[model samples]
Target: MAGRRRWSTEEILDAAAELLRTSDADSFSVRKLAAALGTDSSSLYRHFRSKTELLRAVADRILLAAMDDYSPEGDWKQRITSLALHVREAFGQQPQLASVWGRHASSGTGSRLVMEEVLQALSASGLPDEDIPARYHRIAVLLAALITSEARVSTVTPEEYEQGMELFRVAVLGADPERFPALSRFAREVRPLGVDRRAAFEEILAAQLAHIEDAVHPD
Candidate 1:
C-alpha cells in the first residue's frame, strides 16, 4: 500500500467536494471524507469540531472553484445573468453539497467574492450606490433559491418521479372531473407527470430578471 499522504487544507477541501459530488446526500460523510483523505477520523477532529464544519469548508472552496467558470462578460445585465447562472450551475452540479449549503458556519472567502461581484455588477448596471446592496441581495437570493430547489427536486430519480406522477393522477386528477374541472382539464392537455422543469426554471429566471430590471430601471 502507498504511504499516507499529508493533505493540505485545500487538498482536503477538494477531496471533500469530490466526496459530495460522487456520493448521495445521506451516505457521504466526514468519516468517509477522512478515509478518502488518507487520515484517521480522529485527526480531523482537531481541525473541525463537527462534520458540518469540515463540509462547510469544503463547500466554500467549491464556491471559489465555481468562479473560474463564471465569465462575467457582456453588458451589465448579461454579466449578472451569466454570473448567476454559473453560480447556480455550480451548486446544481453537486447535489449533496447543495442540500446542506449555507446551513453551517463557514470561514471561506468564496461567498464574499460572489457577493462582491454581484454588487459590482449592479453598480455597473447604473444602479444607485445606495441601491446596489438591496438589488444584489434580491438577485443573490433568487439564484440561490432556484439552485437549491433544483438540487432538492433532482433528488428524485426519473422512475420515482413517474411513480409520483401516477400517484398524483390517481389522487387528484382522477378523483372527480366535475369537482376538479380546472385540474382535470389541464391534466387532459398535459401528461400526468410530464412537467418540464427546465421550462419552468427558464420562466422563473425570466420573471426574476424582469422584476430586478424594473427595480433598477423603473420608468
Candidate 2:
C-alpha cells in the first residue's frame, strides 16, 4: 500500500505559506503545492477540489493566524488598530497571497469573526446602527487597498527600493516650475518613503477611524 497519506489541508497550507514567504510571487497551483509537499498533486485535489478552493483555504489560514494574534478587548481605536495591524503583519509575511485575498470581503469563519468585532467596535464608538455597514466597508476597503499596495512591494530588494525612490525624487525635482509649480517648489520635501512606511500608513488608518467617529459624534 502507498499508505493513507501524511499531508492534510493544514500541512498543505503550511507549505503554501512557506512558498509565499520565500518568493516574490508564488504562481500557485495544486501541482506546485503537491511537489512542495512531496506527495501527489492528486492528493491535494482530493481535499481542495480546485485551485480556487485551495486559495480560499490558504487565505482562511492566513486570516485565522491574524485573528489568533488579535487582542479583542480595548478601546475602539486600539482594537481596530490591533486588528488591522495583525492582518497587515500577516500580509507582510506572505505578500504573494494579498491578491488572492484582497478582493474577498466575506463572512467566513475568521473573517466573519473579525468583521463582527469591528462592527461591534463601531457601534460601541457611537456609529449609528444603519451607518455601521457603510463605515465598515470604507474601513475594510481602505485597509485592503493600503495593505495590498504595501504587500505588492514586499519583495523589492534594497537596491531596487533605493533606485525607485531616487527616480521618484528626480522626477519630482524635474517638474517644470511654471506648469508644476507646487510640485517643483515642494519637491525637495518629497523624500522617499524611509524606514517604517507603516508610520504613515497608521496615520491613514487613524484618520479613517477618526473620520467615522467625528461624523457620528461631532463636537
Candidate 3:
C-alpha cells in the first residue's frame, strides 16, 4: 500500500496552486481538491488540518518559485529590480494565486524568507539601518499592489489595452501638470519604457532609496 499510495506535502500544495491559477479561492474547496488528487477529504486533513492551511501552503509554494535561486551579488539595484519583476511575473502567471497571496497575512516561511532577502538587499544600498524595514515594506507593498491591480485590468482586449494606455498617458500628463511637471513631461516616455518592468521597478526603488538617504543625511 505504501508503494501504491503517494501524497506528499509538495504534491498537495502544487496541485492546490495549479487549481488556484485557474479558479478563484472561494471555488477551491478541500473536497474538490481531494477528489482531484484521487484521495478523500479525510486524507487531506492528515496533512493540512484545514483549507486555510492548505491555501497558505499553496501560497508559500508559489512565493518560493518567485525566489528561485536568486543571487545577492552584483549591482544591488539590478538585483532588486530583477526580483520585483520575477515576483510580478509569478503573479501574472497565476492571477488567482497572486490574489490569494495579496489577501493573506503572510505567515508562511517562504514569504518571510523572500521579505528577508529583500530587506537585506535594501540594507546593502547604504540607507539608515532604522529605515530598512519601512523601506522594504513600502517596496513590497507597492509591488504587490501594482501586480494585483494590473491583473484585475489585464483581461482587456489588445486594442482596448492600447487605447487605455493612451488614455492613461493623457490623464497623467494633464492632471496637476504644475505640481507634477516632470511627470507630465515624461508621461509618454514612461509607457514605452515599462516594456522592461524590472528596470522600471528598479529605477523607482532606487529613487526611493535615494530619497531616504537624502532625508537621513542631507549635505
Candidate 4:
C-alpha cells in the first residue's frame, strides 16, 4: 500500500503564503516551504510542478483576496475612490503579493473577475465602453504602484519614516524655488505634515479617475 500524503495542496500553499507575509519573496523556495511544512520538497511536486507554479497559485489567491464586492451605486467618484482604497489596503497587507499581482499575465480567473468588475463599474460611471479596458488597465497599474511604494515606506517606524520624508521634501523643494514655487510654498505651509500615504494616494487616484472620466465624456 502507498503511504498516505501528509499535507494537502491548500496546506502547502497556505504555508508558503505565511512565509511570504513574514519574509521576503526571495526566501520562498520550495525547499524552504516544504521544510516549514515538515515535508520534503518532493512532496510539494505532487501538488505543484515547480516553484513558479506554486508562486502563481499563491499570486492568484492573493489577488482574489484583494478584490471586494464593490457596489456600483453612490457618487461615482466616491465609489471609485473606495475601490482604489480597498485595493491599496489589501496590497499593503501583503507587499510581496502586490509584486506578484503586478506581473500576473496569465489571464487567471481571479484576475479576469477583477477586470470584469472594474470594467462594469467604469461602464456604470458613464465612461464609454470603448475606453473601459484602457482605463481599467491604467487604474490597476497606478493602484499597484502606489500600494507597493507605500508598503516599502511602511517597513520603517513612523518616526524614522517621517524624518526621511522631511529630508526628501527639503531635497525636492530645495532644487529650484522658482521652478517649483508651488511645491515649496506647500511644503512650507504643511511643514513636516506626517506622511498620510493613504490620503495622498486616494487624492491622486481620484484625480486620475476624474481625468479619465472627463476624457470619456468631455465637457
Per lDDT, the best of the predicted structures is 2
The lDDT for every candidate, in the order shown, is: 0.72, 0.79, 0.74, 0.73
**What is candidate 3's lDDT per residue for 27-131, written digit by digit as tens?**
989999888898888888999888888887777776678888566666656667667777777777777776677766357777887788788777777777887
Q: Return whichever of 3 and 4 wins on TM-score.
A: 4
Which pairs clash inside model 2? none
- Encode model 1's per-residue lDDT on 75-134: one tens digit a residue: 777777677667667776776687666455245788777787878777887767987777
Off by over 4 Å in 1: 1-5, 22-29, 35-38, 105-107, 189-195
Measured by TM-score, the strongest candidate is: 2
Q: What is the C-alpha RMSD of each candidate to the true structure, in Å?
A: 3.2, 2.4, 5.2, 3.8
Candidate 2 vs. truth: CA RMSD?
Answer: 2.4
Worst lDDT 10-window in candidate 4: 99-108
CA lDDT, candidate 2, residue 219: 100
In the predicted model 3, the residue pairs found to clash are none
In model 4, pairs of residues that clash are: none
lDDT, residue 197, candidate 4? 76
For 1-219, candidate 4 gives per-residue lDDT tens digits of 977458988888789888877766566689999888877899899998877778778877765676644454576667667767666667777776666566543245666666766777787878767878888889878876787677766656678977888798777667576887877767555644336776788788988888977886788
